[model samples]
Target chain A: MAENILTPEEIIKRGELVFKKTKLMTDNELSYCPGCGHGVAHRITMEVIEELGLEEKTIGVAPVGCSVLAYEFMNVDMQEAAHGRAPAVATGIKRVYPDKTVFTYQGDGDLAAIGTAETLHACNRGENITIIFINNGIYGMTGGQMAPTTLPGMKSSTSPYGRDINMMGHPLKITELIAMLPGTVYVTRQAVHKPGLVRKAKKAIKKAFELQQENKGTTFVEIVSNCNSGWKMTPVDANNWLDKHMLDYYPLGDLKG
Target chain B: MEDVKLMKGNEAVAEAAIRAGVDAYFGYPITPQSEVIEYLMAEEPHKRTGMVVLQAESELAAINMVYGAAACGKKVMTSSSSPGISLKQEGISYIAGSELPCLIVDVVRGGPGLGTIQPSQADYFQMVKGGGHGDYRLIVLAPSTVQEMADFVELGFELAFKYRNPALILSDGVIGQMMEKVVLPPQKERLGDEEIDKRYGSWATTGKKNGRERNIITSLELKPERQEAHNLHLQAKYKEISEKEVRLEKINCENPDYLFVAYGSSARICQKAIQLAEEKGIKAGLLRPITLWPFPSKEINKLAEQVKGILVVEMSAGQMVEDVKLAVNGKVKVEHFGRFGGMVHSPDEVLEALETKIIGG
Candidate 1:
């Protein structure tokens, strides 16, 4: 044999060796709903963390709801915050360790309704943290109930017949609310349902992190996701529903560049 | 060397917050203290000094942002007036329960609801007693001048991170709105890694990449024994803080017949009261508490041996009088003078009280 003549293979071997040295998310069972948008969000967040090479210096704050397994899924330092308190928790982390990147992944119902105070204030005050808000228009983890962003006429457990805007008040458009604040440096709304939008959204999420790296103020990206389990729609149906309903209300692309 | 500057109390607080190496500022615009946020907002301290400042939608959100920033080991703070402070109680309680360190500046206004934007010290009781829920105490510092308002910012941050507890700078409209001369300390860089890691990293919940166990900074303890242990631990910390943090003042206690004690704006009144009494040769003096919660009882005990009586005057209806009595230990009589319900006691009122309570006899 010609002694396995290969110099390029040695470089490949060394690169793989370097990866072995890198601390990455190890084998763990992810209990995501089949074809749920949360899995896509988690994968992208993990990919960003790995790409940014911040596995050690990044702090992840996850709120109650679907992303509760965040600690188990992400290979980084993670903490669980009370419902709607992830912003506050991430604020603490980022403030203490200014060199570290701190971000929170929150659900719509948690961020807009229960955690409204925290999200608004953090973004308004330019807390120097990043927030990934998943707006699915319904509560998924709690067996499908009305959320703060639920469309006016949408029906759920809370609104058995339908959500009467006259009685319940109109659905809140949080992106518009936060984008109006002076402290907010970046605010973008995107959807993970479509492939092109997914690519664009992943870029937006990455840019949000870059803005943080530059010590700019708070960055908020509202990811219009789907809760097939709660929406009672199949994976394909849910994506189609999001395309038709969520984009009209949320409107993808940067609300504030 | 102390660097001096002339500024109003609230503006000094805003400037000092940046000098303290604050990572974030979250607040709402309220009278008396509105200028603090205004200065930060207009001057753009967020970009100038590498500080983060935001004018929040409401007091509720502002304080919660403080709660958020504190958890991350950041030097964070917020400012608001009386009614706004009341709205902040829920988030304050959570911050207390979590034992996170931060600063809150209350430039108080008169209020039961939408009351005047004028000066008042009515929150003495609320700040001293636990204003929020749960069995926790915040370290309260009352500043008397524009100088101390600035000085207290650094001190509050020190005490906050020192005890891993929140520190509040309680001021009224007079001090916050009025300008005065101040000599500020030179800005020091925030704590370095070895210091933070050695002191706080053990408990602070950063990421779990340290090859150690996952860090959790929670106050919840469902089991009775665990809860009891947690309570005892908090009590022990409080006792330690009380022993070390009590600060007070004394004036002309030598062979004195009467002693006067007051704090904040009310204490300023007692100064003139003491002066008026001294013109008539009453040997009166003023004892002001820079730290109100610890109550400065030790100094009161020392004063009790020589003076015939100690008088406690305040803006509230004699709330701090209980603490004065507890401090005096019946060695000398403790008398209280006060005005309540959006009314501040004038120097003449304090003088009258001094005349009836001490000089009359």
Candidate 2:
């Protein structure tokens, strides 16, 4: 039996690299849990910054969540903000260093719940910064508690009997709310569950950063992600469950630009 | 000499900050201290000296904005009243823990909760004792006059950068709203990015240029040993500050039977009380603390041996008196006098307190 396989040296000589990590990602191990989307979200963001050649001038604000330690992974000038204050901090950085590309990476709990004021005000003030919001429907960092983006009838540690709309209120569609603001020049909801969706998410992130470079007010990109551990599902099942439930409420694609 | 301008304490602080070449000012409009931002907005410091002045949504946002700018190695500041300052404690603590240099101005008003907007020295404990959680200290400076208000802005930033810690100008509504003749500092050009990189490049998060490692600005230390080490480092810095940064003004302390310890507007009142006491044949002296956190404890301790008693006059019920008693260490009689709820004590009232409490007792 003959195996038609090219050796590693032959493949290198042929200039074929199926996949490689971006240099903008540091060598530090990610602290995210297995089957979590935070790692993917972080990679795409750094990849976008690298693609834009903004590695030298990019400043990132890491929010308090699973991605709180994103500064350790993202190879750029990073500032860690108190829970949910990333947008306000980013506003400060962008205003003082207007020429630098500034962005904030935040989770649903940080952005939609605790940081609603900061997010809305920063957007309304037309601060020239990019906001990367990750929505996973539940708080994954501090146990699987209900989040502002948790869907009705979705069970969580805080809402064990399934979220009751009357008791828990409705899931907040903050991305849509942000799109309504005049200060937001661009707003989009994307995902990174699959290769195709990952490509789209990367494109959205790139566009957001580009808009910031043009000094064109706030550009918000929300990534509807999956928290497998929080949802008590395998990675594949979590993605499928997100497709079945989350996508309906938070459909992908551009809402504003 | 630069031109002298009759300006409010708050306005002087704004002018001094602009002339000091601060990179940015982020603030919310709070009474008594609103003039600082109002003046900066009207002056458009960005156009004059390339300083970025922004009216933040809240004091919470304002302080974090200062944190963001300061993390990038820029000279930044924020000003607020008591309630607003309370809201900024978290950010201030974070800045302290991270060892980022920034300036904060608290135009103190009466408080325990939404206290009156009148000038009060009630925040003395909060300013000097680290109101926020964790072990940290802000280089607190109390400006007694509008001149010191302007002068302390320069001094606050200098000390902030020198020690890589937050410095505060603990003014009151009286100082913030009152107008006086101030010789404004000469305008200094803002530092360019190159200068900032050259000076603070080792730790500042300016950018990852010159093949430098990415600078991370955060107060989070997950490891217990590392956190303890950071705490010890902070304590050492505070010790250095206490030893080297003690500032006070002594009047008649050389030979006096009674001493008055006061700060901010209260110091001015104490000065008048000293004269009134002298007219009554009571030799009284005043020790005004310019640096409240350092507390001038050593000076007060030295004066304790010479003076028969000490009286602390403030706008609050009694705060700084504790520090005075601690400094005296039971060597002499110590007492406190104040008027709260926006009340200003008269010179006669302070003299009466000294006569009734310290001298007579």
Candidate 3:
């Protein structure tokens, strides 16, 4: 009963704050839609870097998508790459500043579609960097167009009649494909829909950055995310849908290390 | 001490990059300029000066890599041929819009599409008139010899960083492949991280130091008014470059009846053509533009006041001719002549073309 009677100022003065936002995140507001995973992804990433004590030495490359302005939210030195060229851009940064931690934040369309060559070559060359891939199955920023990772029968704007495997071809399992490349030292797939899953995804991101310090090769972390607005579903329904649908194809867990 | 060597233009560029203390070179090899990466790999500048050299999978990746390093306030560069350069335009535009400093060497060959591996100056328009999509200008340098090829590496970086813009070394296949004696500059040490921070701290993404806001290298300004302001700022920088960076060489223009305006290999041809014209008592002079974008427009325009006719020679059908004519503004008769599509015109043909195209017409 004494705790309940404590004043808010007194509780704060007693250093009883349960959780605080990481200073690595800037004051600017995030642009993600309500309940979008990008906000969580961005915070966990910034938290990981902060926890690792690499805040002052991290450089990030942001891709073209809903997270194109990742630089605005994440308070770190950053470069905005054209389309899917984030890996190549990170390669440039890491090579120049071998002591610094460099990573890329890219969307499914950026990583699996237009930027395939850059992503593959960066992985193939084993560039000592981290690639944070956000796979939402659909192109979120482009108004729900079918992405390279869109499900086989998923209905998107481009696949209005539903994706016909015979016509539109198969959805790419790029994370699996990336794990096979010898250049990648660690490759894992994760999600952040729930608090427990968010912690696991953050741990995976932290491990990827830790692996980058070893300078063995490329480390990739693919976060199987949802684009609720693009999916035309409510946030809660999207999470349930992702669990029932997306997880069946993109099972969560480490594929390589 | 100055180190001199006999080397191909492409090789000279590679060697010059090392000597200039470039921090990184990421490039994909292409015909007429493959020697750039080959020489860098063979020499291993990483061992010599701790510079990073990577042969990228494609020109697109190479240019983006250059963008990344440049955004970090490092001296970075990339080289490719015509077709490869075309693939790099997207990155180049992004770099320009971000206002990053880097060098792009284009050892151009003939092209509407992989047209030839031979020496050609057909890329004059593409290089001088903004090859990428944007309201941006690359400080274009035309190197006429293997020596200039080596020298411009330093000059390009200086100009690029001075204004925080991209600088292009525009050499055609002839100069790229030709062997000549070059006086390579002495090696300068690569800039250390602290030094880069000191010099480019205001804008470069050299990591956010304690007590500083994070640096963001980006071209995206979603707000229309802010984007317009950024564009205007870039245009202002370009105007300053055009006013101050015009480089040209005037040969025997004291009193000439006719003038020959050319650059790169075409300038070399016109030098000999001028001698032949003198032998014919034709009194011809040459105005060779060194900086093609911040063109020798002022010099050419002034010279047009004195000459009766001006002949613009290039390897293209008539690319730089438009710039030349614009400069002259009908003050004197201007005509264009050259062999193209992998063809090189002889000195005699240049003289004949000048006689027919400018005088006889």
Q: After superposition, how far is residue B248 of candidate 1 from its true place, in Å?
A: 1.4
Candidate 3, residues B166-234: lDDT per residue as tens digits?
Answer: 999999999999899999898899988888899999998877886688899999999999999999999
After superposing candidate 2, which stretches have Cα over 4 Å from the reference?
A1-15
Candidate 2 to truth, TM: 0.98
By lDDT, the candidates rank as: 3, 2, 1
Candidate 3 C-alpha error for residue B113, in Å: 0.7
| Residue pairs clashing, model 2 | none
TM-score attained by chain A of model 3: 0.94
Put down candidate 2 lDDT per residue, A55-125, tens digits, no spaces: 99989999788888998899999999998889889988888889999999999999999999999999999
- Clashing residue pair totals per candidate (backbone < 3 A): 13, 0, 0
Per-residue lDDT of candidate 1, residues B1-361 (tens digit)? 6688889999999888877877789888888789998888887865656677866667776776677667656688999888999988877877787788999999887766888888877777777888887788989999888989999999999999999999999899888988999887666566555565566677665555457554555555547898888878888999999999988766666677788888887788888888888887788877888898777988888888888778888766677788888888888888888776567788878888888876674
lDDT of each residue in A117-173, candidate 3, tens digit only: 999999999999999999999999889999999998898999988888999989899
Candidate 3: deviation at residue A48, Å? 0.4
**Model 1 chain A worst lDDT run, 10 consecutive residues:** A16-25
Question: What's the lDDT for candidate 2?
Answer: 0.92
